[model samples]
Target chain A: MNVLIVLAHPERKSFNGGLVDVAVKQLEDAGHQVEVGDLYAEQFDPVEHAEQYPHSAVASDYFYPLNEQRAHYQQDTLPQDVQRELARLEWADLVIFQFPLWWHAQPAILKGWFDRVLVYGGRYTSRMRYDHGYFRGKRAMLSVTAGSPGIAFQPFGRAGDMVAWLWPMHASLYYVGFDVLPPQVSYGVQGGGIEYQKEDALRIHLNACKECWATRLAHWEREKPIPFAGWEDWNSEGVLCETSPWRWRLG
Target chain B: MNVLIVLAHPERKSFNGGLVDVAVKQLEDAGHQVEVGDLYAEQFDPVEHAEQYPHSAVASDYFYPLNEQRAHYQQDTLPQDVQRELARLEWADLVIFQFPLWWHAQPAILKGWFDRVLVYGGRYTSRMRYDHGYFRGKRAMLSVTAGSPGIAFQPFGRAGDMVAWLWPMHASLYYVGFDVLPPQVSYGVQGGGIEYQKEDALRIHLNACKECWATRLAHWEREKPIPFAGWEDWNSEGVLCETSPWRWRLG
Candidate 1:
């Protein structure tokens, strides 16, 4: 098995980095080849614009990211960084996104990964999305840390539902044909100032979080992907069919 | 009304740019003071790391972004760019985020805006968030454009729910006590290569979308904010009460 851990945290010494380290060790010990995409360390350009398309631009005047993505991808003239990331994705059987939740989502760098790496006409199209996506057999999961406690992320909590916050990411992964696994959330990650808790307690918590991540990765292959209603569940107008169980639950 | 439109698109001549222009003209025509934060034009550095805090470092060994943000904010030594943005936010009565939805959310530049500008301790703290955030009285709204059509973003649509995509952003704004208005999404925005539609038809569609946006801004003051559950709605554990209406609806 091949595992790609995309680490999006700034500081490599941060807890998020620690999680990636844990994953690499655990996955390697399990006889898997591990490749880590340390976004910050590589200085991954997060902004997707015309500048990325130095060659093979479909329209020179107006920059549509999707068109540029498709053109460059076909021409094999995509930016070196993007080509490298795509190569990594192509090599990986499973991908893990390790990052601290900033403003209830992944950091800009990781967000731009999806924007740039996931080429529209290549990775997905109108008909080639959802279950029929390009990377159908691959699996992906998010390993996120939040500054707020677990309780605050519960439904109707002050921090809002973690499930809801992760839905967009989960959906995107699913759209690209990856079997999306449930997220591993390290809640109440005392980020900068450890004023709230004792040093010993914080250390214990951090270690425990790392252990939990390691344990999860040990059995990742056996875990079931989160259920998402696919094309068959929806009607012609792209809404959930009246008879669909999701309509009753989600509507 | 003092309105700050933070434009996040790369190309200044793109549709997203036109939307900003339309917004400024409309808001100004309605006797509102408008400020456009063209992130790309200004070359705003979106990456927040140790480099952002050159002098104000609580701990030089580890880079904790929140701690640096709080420390720099208190010392009045925040990076010049951050300081300028904070000043704009402070001056604005209503904040408008203008961007193209790249990967089910705002562009990386805009995402970084939320990460950098919204100071952790200064803009929001555990106690001073939600209804009591630092920018309590200010109103913030998202004016987004999507390449997909409206039908594709319905509740069970192929594009996924627009509401879910915007939830993280909406919750983030609401967390900082901004009254988040319903997003103005111009769907089916035929981006760079408009081979599917004729030039005249594309022009008409673009103009209509601009007019719709302009019309909405004309009544900005009278617009009611989208309702979100408040602190009072949750229990000590931060979960919604069993008897709460949300529990019945969401659960």
Candidate 2:
């Protein structure tokens, strides 16, 4: 399998990067092709602006992102970085987003990847989304690190449910037709570990996390994609019909 | 009342910008002071990295974001931009985040604002978060614009729930001790207008939205903040206790 690990953390030596290294090693050992895209090292600009499209296809007076994205895509004048990221996505069978959970979601860099790389018309259109998405055959997953331990992210945990925090991104990936796997969360990953007081315990915890990631990646291909309702579930108004079978499992 | 509207849209002419204008006018007319922080115009660098902390509070070898944030904040050496944003938050009684919902959340610029401006140790400590947060008295709200129609964002909608999309951000705001208000969502605001079939209908809808926002702001002070679980609700391990009285409302 061709795997693209998109690393969004600023520091290359951070625990997030360590997980990426582990994933690479584990996947390569099994003879799978892997490529790591470091957003920070590559200086991926998270902000999307009019400057991104120098050759404005629409009227330059008012900057409309969607219209410009659609125009530039048709004109083949998209920013170089976005093109390259799209190429990586096209090549990968399974894509892993490795990042620290900053402010309850992916860092701005990765967030903007969805904003910029997933072009309006190119990636998704009026009909080319959800189950009928463009990259229907491709799979995506998030491998996240957080300062708080897993216990803190339970249903009623103080830090809030991590799964709920990740729902939007999951929905987005599903919108783009990628079968998104359940996130691999490495909890209590920070400078001095929130759950671990002693240095030795923190080190052990970190090592254990790496081992866990390695094991998970070994059988990643066999994992089922998280289920999401498709077009048939919804009525003409884009809301679930009363008889839709997935109503009970709704977000 | 001192109100700060932090806008993250790339175009000042966009519908999101129009909402900010409406907000400012409504507040100012009521003898309340208002400041519009145009993040895009200000060129707010959303990516938080080593460069944000030049004084080097922590060792430069391995960049630890929390450690650096703590040290820099303690030393009063935070980046000028962050300090400025903090000052704005400090001054405002009500903080309104005005942005188009890009990729199920705030745009990267606004997302980074949370990551960088809300210094980890400075803004929130272990004991000083949730109900005890530094900005406890200050109220914050999201004034969001989405391309999807209201119906598409209903419970079990084809576009997924808008409330669910906004939950992570809501939790983040609550984490920092701000009494987050229910978001003022202006649905179907985009270049071509998704819900409005005719051009005249789109214009009328937008005007109606502006009127609705103006009316809401006129009575904004009466709006109750969204209720979140306090420290009293959580047990020793930070999970909501069985008898917390807030379990049914849990995310």
Where does candidate 2 stray beyond 4 Å? A192-198, B192-198
Docking class of 2: medium
* lDDT tens digits by residue: candidate 2, A94-204: 999999998889999889988999999999998999999999999999999988889999888888888888898898999999999999999988684323335888888
The superposed Cα distance between candidate 1 and the true structure at residue A154, in angstroms, equals 1.3
Error of 1 at A68 (Å): 1.2
Task: Give model 1's docking category.
Answer: medium
Candidate 1 lDDT, B12-34, residue by residue in tens: 88888889989999888889899
Using lDDT, give the best candidate's number.
2
Backbone clashes in candidate 1 total 0
* Model 2 chain B worst lDDT run, 10 consecutive residues: B192-201
